[model samples]
Target chain A: MTNTSQDRILEVKTLWHYYGNTPALRGIDLEARRGEFVTLLGPSGSGKSTLLRILAGLELPTDVNVMTLDGQDVSNIPANRRNVSTVFQHYGLFPHLNVRENVEYGLRARKVPAADRRERALKMLEQVQLSDFAERPIARLSGGQKQRVAIARSLVLEPVILLLDEPLGALDEKLRIDMQVELLELQRRLEMTFIYVTHSQEEALTMSDRILLMNDGDIVQTGTPEDMFDRPNSRFSASFMGVENLFDAKVVAVSDAGLTVEVNGASIEGVWTGASLPSVGETICCGFRSERVQIADDSTTSMNSLEGKLTSHIYKGKYLDLTYQTALGPIRMRSWQSHAAPTETARIAWHKDQTILCPKS
Target chain B: MFRPPTHVAPASYMSFVLIWGLVALLPTAGLLLWSTLTMENFQIVWEPSLQAYRDVLSSGRWQVTIRTLEIAAIVTLIEILLAVPFALWLAKGTKSAGVRTVSLALLTIPFFLSLSSRTIVWRGVLGLNGPINAALLQLGIIQEPLDWLLFSQFSVILGLIGPYFPTMVFPLYLAFMLIDDEVLAASKDLGASPAFTFWNVIVPLGLPGLGAGIVFTFVPMIGDPVVPELLGGGNVVVLSASVQSLLRILNYTVASALSVLMLVILVAMISLVAAITARFAKGGL
Candidate 1:
């Protein structure tokens, strides 16, 4: 195995890939430093997985734009030449081979000496805690065990970086959670760069150092999970970040007092900081995270409190999601540890910063 | 919860199976008992004779068995080496779907062609003034028509190879199809080239069918009388034809004994083949 030089592991520039004229990835620019866990998060058909395939050299971009690893141009390099390993949604374990042979397969392909391959493969089997089942068949292992074996098989080469394409998507919910934690722990222990691709928001939020939010074959936004969640830059981002209270409104006026927007017979005002302030009668929409909106308290300070009837409530262990029918239309809010006035109408308010503004088309 | 009625009652199934089993066993059981017992007309019937068995061992019947086995072994080896590559190509190569369908049709055409018609065609094709000789002569590849093309071991083998290629190819193809493309991609992503992937990943997965195909083609070739009868002429008398001669001469006892001997040899060959295949097919779940 080669030593990991502390250099940029991969850099993709303006990558555009297409499938028979249908755009799969458009103008994707990304860079992975030597050892970072970057997860590509998006909905289905968001080009996240396509981007991973491009980076792994399994796919070629429509244009031969520069893609480099450790400063070496590898845009057209075959997957075998790149020292990157990928774990697929299906484990793709060779059904015919036992665990030990499957793990040793890559080493043999690399033309490692027989003695070295055995040594390295046995060590890898031990690392994945499958030493006891080294001789056991791959098909006999449970889902989690098969995935671990797949990881061990890929990791045996000590790959420069590992690409995981929805590796935990096939597992049940409890197992998926367990695997997420396990994978994060493994990545931390190995200190190897992991480029994970998934469409699950919770998965991205749970385990990404930084997430690339992709939409419609492009990277819509890229930020740390907290940044993307707490301050999503657009309506799409807000929705993707699990912000539920998004509404279309028109800006009625902006003054030193504050900015006011008229919506559904209710006028809501908040401090505005958007670069392009909407003119009067200009259509705009705003969003807020369900948790950011709360039941009005006596100590709270806000000029934007709305009197709304409590329409529906669903209790979660930590928080209850409440639907409030105010004059501004139904607004969803999340409350922690308590429910207020579910029987009839109530007032809900939030700080100015909690409100997000976006241009409405 | 209501239970569904069992259509095949256990008693009926057992009785059915036992009847078929007895039907199959009766002839073999009869042969075994006849081979062991003294006949009422001892001189004419059984004669309590181990003589046929002795004749089998002494009259170069053992040599014929060896020759039959050797020829089948060589044929199986050659068939596998040639057929496997084509099978793999047919199964995994990026040929157009129409081409694949057509080529598969070509492989299967010989199976439906009458055996007698195929042999007659081979005779003409391989004849001295046949198309092959004429083509070779016109191309200046040969000065004389090759008389050795017909009525030889080579011709018999050519005949065997023609009919048996599909048998060999079909199983290997099925096995190759069973290999998941993800597994192939995973191997590639793990830094294996196409060649390495085929040997380490594809071949192991496809072995059981490869083994099965070899067994299917080999076992029958050992006892096939037609190939030798039409193509071997007087130059070759494989074991099956020799057994036929015994039957023709009204040596039913000897023919039966010869068939039983052939059966024993076939069982041994099958077991050997099974053992080899079982070694590779383990853990293929």
Candidate 2:
């Protein structure tokens, strides 16, 4: 299902925010389609949380050209007047209100009748599998249950957009993975636009339909998780997505297939993955994922190969991480195959298509 | 395994409890006993009787007790209404640390001054020819100086509010400060207006402080002799003033009876507040 303008639930244009003189976001544009799970993936202070807060109307941007929610201009609306709700990182449920009462608060604020409020709150609690916990105090809840209640409290309002500010950050690893699945399912069933902000790349890859990779107050790349993982467009994006074998190279030759780059007197062939290809003699960065490398045997006839001395091997449960000292620097590889005894000298080979070129900066 | 040393030993704990009982509880128990005795021929009669309490009822001293409670309740309510928003502003609304520190220092200044010294200043302000009446007359609001301005129950209540206001504000400030900012943001994000958030989230979460403010302001206000003496100008008699008059006549039994009655009223009020707070703690406001 391709999303067009008619499907866009939230649109922000030319938004900028500053804390006094320090800018947090520098004139960024964002859009989310109906029922789409868009993750703002970035490190702390990358403006992801600031963008979410602006969307939820909890924080006003320093300047904005346009902001629309569900086809209406909401640039001037306060948080309480907007049709957006945020699930805070700490699951800021009211300690003075019980589970169901916390859920009913938004409805009550909107002046919904008492009977309808209770019924709707109970229904939302049941959807989160917390029907039995409706009367329990917030202090009595576990971390995961509190997260569900936070989500339920926001969803009970039936807002146009739901903003989640690292809502699962406090949970343990297993529970966090489980909650990610639950949240994805919940968003799918509700058909509500979800704007989730998190710093974990794996979480973005696992849960997002589209990911916006942010760095240094700007969104450096936006694409599907697979596209972001395989075809990062910048040095920042490449390293952020776990591409460990990155080297500075000078382009020596360009062809229809790819470009040949020289790194430390070694000619390496890498695909031109960017929108525009650099001409010969331009300096650039080349990278490839460690899992894409393979140990080349004597019988193998791969032209793209590197010979280096074995440095170290770490035995991970699922894969072996091997590092080699090469002319270009240390090249790391993750191998899933059961390898033979380590040799001092080894040949590591990768396909040209697996190589990615990024801007050196 | 290494164990942390205990802070209080068993013997010390017992002795501390004993000392507290001897210092605090013994006097109240003695007063309770004294209230049940009778006085005759200007001598102490050790026989237990309810004649002192009976005399208090017949002599119309019970009216003073009821009136004192009414004034205390009214002043506590007024302080609550005034202090909650001010405390909220001091704790959460204001952004400047300097402003918060200055405001807190201002609230605490009254505690450093004597109660009589602070209360005596109000007499000059509330008197018939005081600036308040002069300003009212100058503004064409009143035709003549209002004689009932200083020496009435109104002035007594007015005088009591300023001395006890800091008590109400301090606890509320602490409570409001402890509330997390994200909880408030979540409330607004969930579509609660500012007013709704105040009543639903801020007030309910501030119950412990509200209960404390009420007890701190109300209990002391009921027994305040200085404000009534200075502002009431001996025109309005409350329980404390009545107890003093009974003592002056060497009626220790009746004085102790009045003190015991005041204690009963205060305990009943505090218990009601504690019960309400406990219920809300389990459920919600």
Cα lDDT computed for each candidate against the true fold: 0.81, 0.90
**Candidate 1, A1-361: lDDT as tens digits:** 2334445688888888888889898888887876688989999999888888877788878875778887788888878888888998898998878899889888888889989998899999898788899888887999999999999999999888899999999999999999999999999899898999998989998999889999999888788888777767667877888878888878888787567887776777764535566688887777777787776776455636788888898988777888998877788888886554454777888776667766652
* lDDT, model 2, position B114: 92
iRMS of each prediction: 2.0, 1.2
In candidate 2, residue B25 scores what lDDT?
A: 95
Error of 1 at A45 (Å): 2.8
TM-score (chain A only) for the predictions, listed in order: 0.91, 0.96
TM-score of chain B of each: 0.85, 0.94
Q: What CAPRI class is candidate 1?
A: medium
Instruction: Return the lDDT, model 2, position A170.
Output: 98
All candidates: TM-score = 0.87, 0.92
Residue A250 accuracy (lDDT) in model 2: 95
Measured on C-alpha atoms, candidate 2 has an lDDT of 0.90
TM-score of 1: 0.87
Mind sharing the TM-score for model 2?
0.92
Supply candidate 1's per-residue lDDT for A345. Answer: 71
